[model samples]
Target: MLSDKSRPIIQATLPAVGAHIEEIAKCFYGLLFAAHPELMDGLFNRSHQADATQQQALAGSVAAFATALVNSPDRLPENLLSRIAHKHTSLGIQPEQYQIVHDHLMSAIAEVLGDAVTPDVAAAWDEVYWLMAYTLTHVERGLYGARGVSPQTVWRQWEVEKKIQETDDVVTFVVKRIEDHLVKPSLPGQYISVQVPLPDGTRQSRQYSLSRADQGDSRQFSVKRVHGAAGKPDGEASTLLHTNVSVGDVLTLSVPFGPLVLDDYSGRSMVFISAGIGITPMAGMLSHLATTGSALPIMLLHADHNENAFALRDQIRDDIVALRHASIYVWYEQGADSKLPVQGVFAGKMDLSHVRLPDNAVYHMCGPVPFMHSIRSALIALGIPPRDIQYEMFGPDLWQADYE
Candidate 1:
């Protein structure tokens, strides 16, 4: 909770701070990287940094956290905090790093706002920063403890056992522990960070969702080659994984971490919704449920460019059939499978009205932001509570503030 003295100050200056949060974030990253270039080596995603999505995410989160502190002094934003904590834990973010961020961030705010930043105003925002930082640190500590590993010990080497090309742009890698150690099991919908050493002698890390149920000594994850648009750089880590990595190559991996697990949906109908490469986590969840012999009702609603573009189609279809009460639905925008079994295929964009939604169904979605936003709105119109719908983002979570 914000102190009474700081609350009023934050409430009064929020509009001003929010207006220039982006500038402040840009300045903060500049200062941070200039002083600590080591952070860029493996901790931060160079692609996100170059594209400025990371800056936008930082600006949005700070403004949202400050706004929440003023509006709901008694309650913290669990969704925002949990998402950040999981990502941080996967990247092995330590507690001391928060202070370094605070110093640079405060300096950036001072530099950006100039004379408008009075001492009282600075102190108030400082309080807000620490409140968020400490809370995140506490949550991240719990995550590390629960995983039974500290930040330094979270990474392990795994040898790629198999590489299967799923589509023109997607590839799946199955990896096993090199030292024959017992690996921590990954929950459905969780992701692990893979750190790859590039040819230029620097390492970059990216997170990929586990695409199948955990085998005792191995894990499976799918990566989509990110083809950069005009004037953008292609994904370095993903490109390396696709072109250079082979069946015998070793890669560094983090323990599984993500907040979108299905622990609370035990007795309810589960709806897995995805498009593009977002099907990875949904496939993982389906695999787990099928392996456990779960009898819960399940509905899989997916969208893709065409049948040929749909990754894991055969695997997920088999898993759905393995479950006693489950159904699969697909929407292909480009083409349809004429020879396919006739029940649940549709043409064009996804329309929820075309299918029947089950009672007490919890919706899990992952895809482009626009797609999720459309599906979320449709679900809300159908009387589903916003709380009942969860989404996993592929990159920096820039839309969290909008959802709040």
Candidate 2:
């Protein structure tokens, strides 16, 4: 129960907080790390901590919820709620984690707002936070229930027994050993966390989607180098992977898990839309779909900066031709002279608005945050059912707004 004086501050600041959630979240993280250095071993990835942009998505999403809660007098946009929940869901965020965040976040907000704060504002925000938390908690519980698993039920590390490059930027790593598991069962679309030592000697983990949809002994994951951020072009983990990490290099591995999967997508026209490195999972899905003989209007919508950066473009084209009901829409951001089945392959940005998103399609999408937001909004406007749509963002799953 918050005091009456704090109510307005909670309300007035939330929208702005939502708008600039990233900044607030940054502050929260700073305080958390500064005050509780011990939490880092289990919580913060040292490599990711160095890359500020890497954690911005997570913080921004948390702040977004804070902003929305202040306006809880009116129901939050269902899309916002769902999108946020999904984002948290992807990172294996738990309900207890929310309470911890709320406590620290409220403290941070009070500190930020200073003398202007009051009891009512705090109470209002508290109620709102708990309410929003309730929404996500229930949904997440249902998701866990459906899976019949507990939080962190699947998280582990592995050693890189062998590695090979599928392309200049994309590499395939074969995990030969992990904690207690020389072999483990992992579903396709699930990913393993590859921990790499950065230049600073600190370590980080990046999730790479498995190239196959099977629970087998020899598990493989394909990772695409992520460039084009404000800081550096090539990310540290990927750069190290391409330039340094080699066979016999052991990397911490997590039990493969992700909301995005090839299952539960049966008998549907699987529309796979990917931009740049986002195509990694799509390649796996396409490859698996081809083998399973259930390719239904599998439109592999791929957009790249230019012809040179089109990862696995030729493979998708070739597979599309071989498999019935499969095709590729190639969009080179710079320009493409090729007379491909380009359903509007211009040398500009690929926005989701131009495409007549097929109806009754089970959508599997991945891209930058802004790109995913654009496509998600377009899909909703086009009357696509939320369940029919699936997406995975680069940084965090803040798809609380994108409810399925």
Candidate 3:
């Protein structure tokens, strides 16, 4: 809880700070990277920095946290904090790094606000920062403890046992721990961070959802080569993995860390919706359900550019077939071939009007923000409560600020 004295100050100055939060975030990253250049190597996403998405996410989160503190002092944003904590733990973010961020962030605030940042204002905002930081540190520590590893010790080396082409642009790597020990098991829908050494001798890291159920000693993750369009540069980590990584190669990977697991499916119906590369996690869950012989009614809905563009198509089909009670519906913008093997696939965008939505079903969705937004809106309109819908995103969560 915020002290009574600082609450009024934050409430009074929130408008000014909110208006300039983006500039402050930009300045903060600049100062931080300038002082700690090594952070770019494996900690931060270079593409997000280039496009300013990371800065916007940082600014929006701070503004949201401050607003919540002022308006709903008794409650915290558990969803937002959980998402952040999971991502941080996946990237091996340590507690001490929060202080570095705090110092630079405060400096940036002062520099951007100029004379308006009186000592009282500084102290008030400082309180807000520490409050947020402490909460995050607490959450991250619990995540690390659950995994039985410290932040710095969460990484391991895995050898690429095999690589399978899923689509023209997507490839799946089967990796095994190099030490021949039992790997820490992961739940369905969890993800692992893959760190690769780039050509310039700097290691870049990216997270990919575990594409299969936990099989004890090995894991599978798919990577879609991110080709630059409209003048942007190719993705550094993805391009490196696609062009250079091969079977028998060694790669650094973080322990599995994600909160989107399917913990219970006893009697409730389940709906899995995904688009593009977002199907990876859904596929993981499906594999688990099928392998475990779950009898729950499952509906798998997916969208893609075309039949040829669907990653893990055969795997998904096999998993669906393995289940006791399951159905699949697909939408393709380019239209699947008339002779295609799958049944009940549609052409054009998804239209749930004709589909039968199961009662008391839990919905899990992942995709581009726009796709998820449209599906979520439709689901809500169809009487599913917002709390029943869970989603995961590949990049910084810009959607939270927009939707909230």
Candidate 1 weakest lDDT stretch, 10 residues: 334-343
Candidate 3, residue 395: the lDDT equals: 85
Instruction: Tell me the tens digit of each residue's lDDT in model 3 across 60-125.
Output: 889889999999877677787788899999999999999999999999999999999999999999
Worst 10 residues of 2 by lDDT: 395-404
For candidate 1, the lDDT comes to 0.90
Highest lDDT among the candidates is held by which one? Answer: 1
What clash pairs does model 3 have?
none
lDDT of 2 by residue, 153-224 (tens): 535455676686666678777766556633345554656556566766566667777765442455667778
| Model 1 ranges with Cα > 4 A deviation | 180-182, 338-342, 401-403
lDDT of 1 by residue, 260-342 (tens): 99853469899999998999999999999999999998888999999889998878878987889888888999875633332
User: On a 0 to 1 TM-score scale, where does candidate 2 land against the true structure?
Assistant: 0.75
lDDT of candidate 2?
A: 0.65
